[model samples]
Target: MTLASQHPMTMFGPDFPFAYDDWLSHPAGLGRLPEHRLGTPVAVVGGGVSGLVAAYELMRLGLRPVLYEAGELGGRMRSIAFADHPDSLAELGAMRFPPSASTLFHYIGLLGLATRPFPNPLSACTPSTVLDLGGVVHRVRTADELPTDYQAVADAWDKALQDRAELSSMEDAIRRRDVPAIKSIWNRLVTEMDDQSFYGFLAASSAFESFRTREIFGQVGFGTGGWDTDFPNSILEILRVIYTHADDDQVSIVGGARQVPAGLWTRTPGRLAHWPAGTSLSSLNSGRPRPSVTRLSRTGEAITVEDSSGARQDFAAAVFTPHVWTLLGRIDCAPELLSVPQWTAVERTHYMNSSKLFVLTDRPFWRDTDPRTGRDVMGMTLTDRSPRGVYLFDDGPDRPGVMCLSYSWNDDSSKMLTLDDGQRLAVVLRQLKAIYPDVDIASHVIGDPITVTWEREPHFMGAFRASLPGHYRYQRRLFTQFMQRGEPDARRGFFLCGDDVSWTAGFAEGAVTTALNAVWGVLDHLGGATAPENPGPGDRFDELAPVDLPF
Candidate 1:
């Protein structure tokens, strides 16, 4: 195969080529609505990235956006600081970001936040990586240093991507934002691959004939670690991830990922339509968002939102950005808000359970060299042990540091859901001791351990959405909710926007792009139009829309 054919294509997926941040930053501003609609109020539920982006953009377009959140402002992008060392943080939600997430990076850059390359397994940022599988330890400084069999497994993955997915062509189109090329390549793949699972794709490929190779690939995946949990998920989802290089060239915010939304919450816009020159999202809400929306009732043209405190308010339109399950169960939503198909889509949405355990360390002791071997005592680790992945965070020699003792998902996370902090710590410590007998991890631990089981959290039932095989139709219905305004006024006024509603779930970029989609929806609903020079995603949605698969 030629060089181009040897690589898998990168796909922008449903995000397409729309640059939402650019549209919002346009000189003319998001197309003007009539003076009568300028001061109209709109309700934005779930004050996470989606809600914040929607509210901020709406406020700029001369609309009164009333934002509501049940818990913290950052939502899943939460970054918690240690009680003893406030400067350091342990990310409970999103930690790393890929450069392909242009929408999110736009906000990050606008906020002037600094980012450093994430120390993914076998990456240069990681001094070393230990792959402990089947009671065998393979420590390597790079992928080339891995055992011959492991190297073959990696090569097979690359070959499979090229042969089966057209990864190179897809990536080229995505990088150039070539909408036609992307659609031409991706539309065909959707028909061919939507119904398939990641594991099925692997099985069908010629890259791995032996079960051992397949098992090794699933058990110790490239980039972060094992991806066996994702095997049963839609191949489309996996394609989106690999195509966008979501697992490569990763970076994390200097302080925390949460700052992206938090910064936008308080940022002073360059242009203003109705609000004052220096008005920000926080100023618009008087520095406090309204309580969580407990109920949503639609009467004729308006939506009445009830908060946890029994307070009710009516708005011209409403945006729901919370997890689908929350909207389905936590809130007393009127059935008319969503169609039966939409409700079924929401009910059947699958969310992956994720858990993370972190501890504050006195120093970056892991960087110490082993006098005997002349290698760093501790590095990024991936093992079949209970603590599947171990990551180290160094904040200089003077300041205290943090260590993610264990980061797991699904059944692995479920195992630790009932364990207390001490118990979780003990489990991780024991696992680490087996992996690194010479390294004393427990001795460096300083403060109380912090752990989270996202599924158990009341506000967020799960960490992120992961679509199962044959669920493309359901996802399509969910994603296209922003455009379904042809019906009764009730359904027209209530819109859905979130990561779960996006084609690319579990990423901040998904939340941002979907929020922008809702912004355009709300704009069009209120009789606002996008400027011809800078058209929004809704403007070209049909041409660059997702592929429609036949069930």
Candidate 2:
């Protein structure tokens, strides 16, 4: 008898399965631009991870990238720091990341960033977990101790995913990186399930016949938190997360996720192209990015951009990496820039709302054991209440600790949307008191709470895009927009990138991979070609393109 373990699963997609990580690490660089096109100016709107990646690679190819940022660099990867506690950080945006995000990890490795396992609920990194639902609290070290009914609900969801979605086979194909098998299984699912909602998929499954079972599954989801808000979203979205293991084996950056974009901005690549050895994106942009781009339009053959400073620059190409709403509502754009179908997709993009509240504590007081109970005073808490999820961070016994008081999404997030900072803190603290009556979290609090509601942010109207039922067509149109092989020459120069423009939205892996796609688009537009040995995404576009569905 023989046994062979499965290969590690990367975000090598069923949608577009080009090995971006391979292309990046190849001895031959991404591609080369013509001698005449060297030093050509390109507009990169928003200084987020996507924008910075595109800009950095563009600079490496001997092109000039003029970045315009409406807010601070790093976009949704925001980390709030307090004046007194420099060691603690309140991650208002992206806190945890999955290790399967190879493209993003590629940048993390290059930046020399360190990562540790984030304390997810019932995860190995977490000391203990308290699950509170319907005013009942149950403390446990793992899911094994939960009631048999809880296990039943989990088993039901697993059965449905396996039977209805062919999850096991699909995951096996993904682990093997079998392009034909991945495409075969996925394209069929796309055709059959494009119009199906997450809730509908469960309802159709015989294992999840009970409404109560479905409800339990929604409140306490598989790896992350609640899934009730995601019920209305397309089943394909959920399948994408599960198939690629986007929710499993997650880790947080040692310092914070914001360091990724900041590092890219400041880092001088070891392998320099046309630019001098010491040059970097920060150096090229005069130490900082340009102001917000107020207007975008085509002037003859060039893409003209006007910033908040009233300075205008005509570039040979442009890459947009913000939420589509920023372009549609905030910035003025020429109608001729996109096709009619592309405009509809942008207008129809649905985004999920997210809210997070964090507080600095005096010390790791939660680690204090109760004399009577012999358990830590408090554990990472998950409740059906408004707070939804509470995470505790312990640096050391001597140093201060951080507590993520509340993390909510969609309906749960809406409840806290109108509350002020004090009100937000009070709400979560009150909820925690219900679960941990013996412990007083307020007594340990050292500073005012830090909070952010993604929906309230002017530049980013929503947290991230979540395609609703029947949005597969829209998702396809936007993701494939970077391949403008048949577009008019004037319109060809403009391209789009970001998680919003990617199949796997809401994950940074999507953002970075889409940036690679746009980089390939910009290269092709500038009369450049990737080396035959290590072809870019566009180089293999025709062979590995996503399956086209009838409109």
Candidate 3:
């Protein structure tokens, strides 16, 4: 029987009908605060997607949320525009967004932004894909065109998922939003696989017994490219990515991915509580957000926050969305702000280093077809060479195009950190020329290359979190921070929300999900209520929650 026939309800994987947009648009709309609590001020740190989403939702709920940021508002959703070609953009951080990111799509639809299928390695948009490993180049028009050995690797991955993880049944429950069913399946898996590394899982699988097959799988992954670095990570983390289909059917915003949060910053709500109908997040902050938060401490029932400029204010509650290292090292946070275990969780959190280098081309030269072969001269490329992944962007035949020469992670990224922009561009161009000997990549370059090493950036210590094997207990403590307000001597007024604090880390949806959780937590702290008919996640958290790993 087909996989779908076995689990008919498994349509969209873990992306269920959470209806976050509907909850925000309900008649009561996240419920309202008491008359006296209206306009109660709340502090929001960081100006990234999470903090911006939290501030936006809180404002709609009759709360005055003061936002503080150390850098530009979009955070990792940064897009750099070419000097000569303003329409051409180079995404330094998040580029492709999966269709499974429902909460993010809600805002994308609301903002009236356009998106097109991203040119991932083997996607339809990618006219051709060249996979070069061990100096052997294999060109394919579709995934099926790949060599027979690659097919075996793909089949092995499928069999492993089904045999070890009960992939079909778990996915069926997740897609249907069957809370109890999901808990039952996920809880057992958490207990079974929590201690295993992704590499370990693969090694134990009978299908991947051949070391050569395993090596090929690591270098050239299924949807994207390369899983070598991820092999050391928790197997549970890999399962989450696969089960959610977070790596498939991805698209990028037409202008830039950063436009999502930037749009939210200026978007005016249809129905608001304390503010006027036209009041936007920008207007609420008097056209500029407060300075970055440098210190935080709890005094009585209120929390006091100090900014980089030494300005201070007290609020009943605060939300922190920056990398945990920022709180531990850059800011002077009081010990009482977090419990000992929570602090340990923060300290143990692992963030991956990422780097990208981009150049504006005079035209989409890669689209040109070679007469002899009848194939595009250049296409999306994955190589064992220094430049791991090469992506081409075409605005129009007449307009300038952008090319991401190199997008590397971890060690690949760190090696280039010491090189200046010019040096990095030279290295990338050399690598590209070596891969495509006939394509004159350097001559098409029309502007200076732009590069970003996320680790070297002081404001953002790293790109995103990647959980190590056996780190589930630490992650559980961090993910459950929103539920600790009621505990005695707990970090009552302070809440944490970010991709790092989510079960599925390193995705925009995770950031948005955790942000909404903090919003609900703040609502509860303010004595507000969620509508009974449309209960928020927090209202049913116990029933829908994932299993917590026992220490």
Best by TM-score: 2
Provide the lDDT at 68 for model 1.
Answer: 95
Query: Model 1, residue 503: displacement in angstroms?
Result: 1.0
Q: Return the candidate ranking by lDDT, descending.
A: 2, 1, 3
- How close is each model in CA RMSD to the real structure? 2.3, 1.2, 2.2
* Counted clashes in each candidate structure: 10, 0, 0
Over the stretch 28-59, how does candidate 3's per-residue lDDT look in tens digits? 67776788999999999988888889999999
The segments of candidate 1 whose C-alpha lies over 4 angstroms from its true place after superposition are 1-11, 14-17
lDDT per residue as tens, model 1, 1-551: 55544534332563355666567567777777888999788999998989999998899889989999998889989899999688889999999988878778878888999999888899888888888998899888999999999999999999999998898787877666677887888888888887799999999989988889988998889987798878889988988888888788788899998898789899998887888888998987899999988999987678999999999998999999999898778999999988888999998899989999999999998888999988888888888877888888886887787999999988889999999999999999998888789888889899799889999998788998999988888988888888855776668878899899988899888999899889888999988888898887878778777777765
Q: What is the lDDT for 86 in model 1?
A: 80
lDDT of 2 by residue, 489-522 (tens): 6667888899989988899999999999999999
Candidate 1 vs candidate 2, TM-score winner: 2
Q: Would you list the C-alpha lDDT of every candidate in the order shown?
A: 0.86, 0.90, 0.85
Whole-model lDDT, candidate 3? 0.85
Q: What is the lDDT, from 0 to 100, of the residue 45 in candidate 2? A: 94
